[model samples]
Target chain A: MAKRTPLYEAHVAAGAKIVDFAGWDMPINYGSQIEEHHKVRKDCGMFDVSHMRAVDVTGKDAQPFLRKLFANDVGKLTIPGKALYSCMLKEDGGVIDDLIAYYFAPERYRVVVNAGTADKDLAWMRQQAASFDVTIADRPELAMIAIQGPNAREHFWTAFPAGRARTVLLQPFQAVEWDGWLVARTGYTGEDGFEITLPAAQAMAVWNKLKDAGVAPIGLGARDTLRLEAGMNLYGLDMDESQNPLESGLGWTIDLKDPKRDFIGRQALAALQPARQFVGLVLLDRGVLRSHQKVFAPQGEGETTSGSFSPTSNKSIALARLPVGVELGDTVEVEIRDKRLQAKVVKPTFARNGKAMI
Target chain B: MSIPAKLKYTATHEWAAKNAAGTITVGITDHAQEALGDIVFLELPEAGRQVKAGQECAVVESVKAASDIYAPIAGEIVEANTPAVDAPESVNKDAYGTWLFKIKPSNPSEYDGLLDAAAYEKVAAEH
Candidate 1:
């Protein structure tokens, strides 16, 4: 049997189209996915993201252990509740998982990982934490809900006002605690909002309360499209264990500043050269670029890692890995069916904060 | 779910209408279009293209994935749906109204063997 979130009944009552996602019974959409997408872009929407695993790391060696654990240095997080996005890599410089690490203190931190990769991520962390005094705890008892959009914060504040005391001034990538709950000003969508992690028993109540407060219940379908438009990388598609972070439009997450930090895969990442790079593609013609489709750049052959129609832009776009020489504003041909469609290469980002950048 | 009583259906979810001239108009059922939400692109066979029964004749792409549109019976294409190509979502909005392509069937007796509306609805509800 597939696992169910605390808000599963709520989703059913909302007339959601349920589907199996990563061993969990989740809602793909409540009704029209495009309408939900537009709702988030123009106003407010909420998503049940409880399937993602939140692991707490505590002990005197937490900071030092994490420095040695990930490719990107966590040392940059000086303030409490500051979150950093990083990729955990293997010794060969291949990505293990991309995650967000929030620093509460030198000895205390919280990391959120993908649901499908949670088991492997925890096992890997446990194996590495053996040498340190750090404790890795996965909090499955906690449920997370992400309310995202332009007016999301206002609606969420109306649902639970206690968070306002600690989070009223919280900036992006910051978090505050309220009644043992972690309300973080972070989201996967390219919009302003919060991701609240609270006790599982209270998950449904809070979800309904938020809905009563006028927040739309979005699902996995809109979530995928929103993230794709935001140029955010999906774990299974954009980067896998065999793919390098540098070639997956995630080089910014990699810290090459410390040559002596001696993190896992640091040496390999330093020595490894990026032959192909990831860029955004705008369909100049009338077609959608799909994953695994061959992209014939002027320099060399490439492939699209993630592609979809952007509801905000009203056009089909994609993130394709092309030869290093292929820069922005260049033209590339994507083979769709039997026809080669022309597409323009732009920087691999379109929307952020509910505003279109392109 | 809207399988028109006047139209005949196949086990693969395709609906066909027999014209007085013996040609058959074919499109996917409403249930099929609803299952594949928010159509984005469509690739149909060219006019006069010959295809066999149950053969893959066209492709339909939604926001999620791509699926093949199979021919219900053996026939040669006399006309194709050009409007659905540009506005593919019309298929999801009204499946029966937007006919995909017209096929000039080699044998008109094939229509008799097709499933009726009630039978097709039962098949769709089973899943």
Candidate 2:
């Protein structure tokens, strides 16, 4: 039997179609995934993302430990409640996981990792902390709820009236704690929203309250499409331990400006020359783009990492790893079954803030 | 869940409706559409194509995965639904109302071999 989240009962009550996702029995959709996808883009929708783990690091050496663990510079997070998106890499510069780290203080930080990589991430962090003076605490007792859309913040304000004053003041990539809840103005959907982490015991109650406040319950199916449309990358689908950030469209997250800071994977990354380019594609045909499809450009053949139909754009889009010679506005042929269809190369972000960026 | 008693069904979850003109209209069952989630793209065989029973003649791509639509009986494709090809979501909205393709079956009696409403209900329930 797959593990169940605290809101499993609530999902069943809502008549959701349940599926096993990363060892957890999660809701794929209540009904009509397309409608659910549009609900998140146009209005407010709530997703029970409790399966993702939150690891807390504390003690005197927390800052230094995190600095060595992640590719991005955590020292830039000078303000409390500020969040940074970074890639935790192995010694060879291969991406172990992409995560969001929220700095609370010099000795306190919380990092949220993907659900499937939680156990591996915790084990890696623990092994790396063997020589450090930090304690890595896995907080499975906490559950996360991502309320996203154009009106997501308004719905959050309506649902949690007490949190409005403080949450409203939070800028993008910032978080605030109030009444045992951590509300972060960060989301994967490329929309203005909040990802709230609270005690797992309160998950069901909060979910019900949000439902009563007219927040539609979304499922993982829409979540994937939403993140894809936002030009965000999925961990395993987009990149893995064999892939480095430089070739996986995550080069921006790597901080190599300071030579004195010796972070893990720094040496391998510094010695590497990126040969592949990660880009977005807009299908010129009336078919859907799927992952693992062959992409042929003038330079060479590449593969699509993630692909889906974009409801916001009313067209199919995908994130592909292509040859470095492939530039923007160039046309590439994607092998969909026996046919090679034309697609236009463009920026990864197809939509943002409830608007189409393409 | 909405199994029309008048139509015949295949174990693969396709429904076939015989019209007075002898052409059989075919589409996926409501249960099949529900399982497939939101329909995104559909690939139907062109008209004038010959299809055999149990042969995969069409493809329905959902947000989650792609599923094959098999031929219920051997027939010549007379007409393919253009609206369903243009807007695949119509199949999710009303699977029965949005027929995928119409065929002139070579063996019209093959429809009698398909499952009835009661048999199809059992098959759908097992899924």
lDDT of model 2 at residue B84? 78
What's the lDDT for candidate 2?
Answer: 0.93
For candidate 2 chain A, which ten residues in a row score worst on lDDT?
A155-164
TM-scores for candidates 1 onward, in order? 0.97, 0.97
Pairs with steric clashes in candidate 2 = none
- Using DockQ as the measure, the top candidate is 2
lDDT of 1 by residue, A1-358 (tens): 9999999999999999999999999999987888899899999899999999999999999999999998889998999899989999999988989999999999999999999999999999999999999999999999999999999999988987766677889999999776778989999998999999999999999999999999999999999989988999999888999988989989898887876789998888888899999999989988777888899987899999989888788788888889999988998999998789999998878777677767
> Model 2, A1-358: lDDT tens per residue?
9999999999999999999999999999998787898888888799999999999999999999999999998888999999999999999999999999999999999999999999999999999999999999999999999999999989887887887889888999999987788999999898889999999999999998888889999999999989998889999989999999998899999998888888999999989988898999999987889998999998999999999888889898999999999999999999997899999999999988878877
lDDT of 2 by residue, B28-110 (tens): 99999999988989999899999999999889989888889999999999999987788899999899999999989999999
Report the C-alpha displacement of residue B82, candidate 2, in angstroms.
Answer: 2.0
The residue pairs found clashing in candidate 1 are none
- Give the per-residue Cα lDDT of candidate 2 at A348: 95
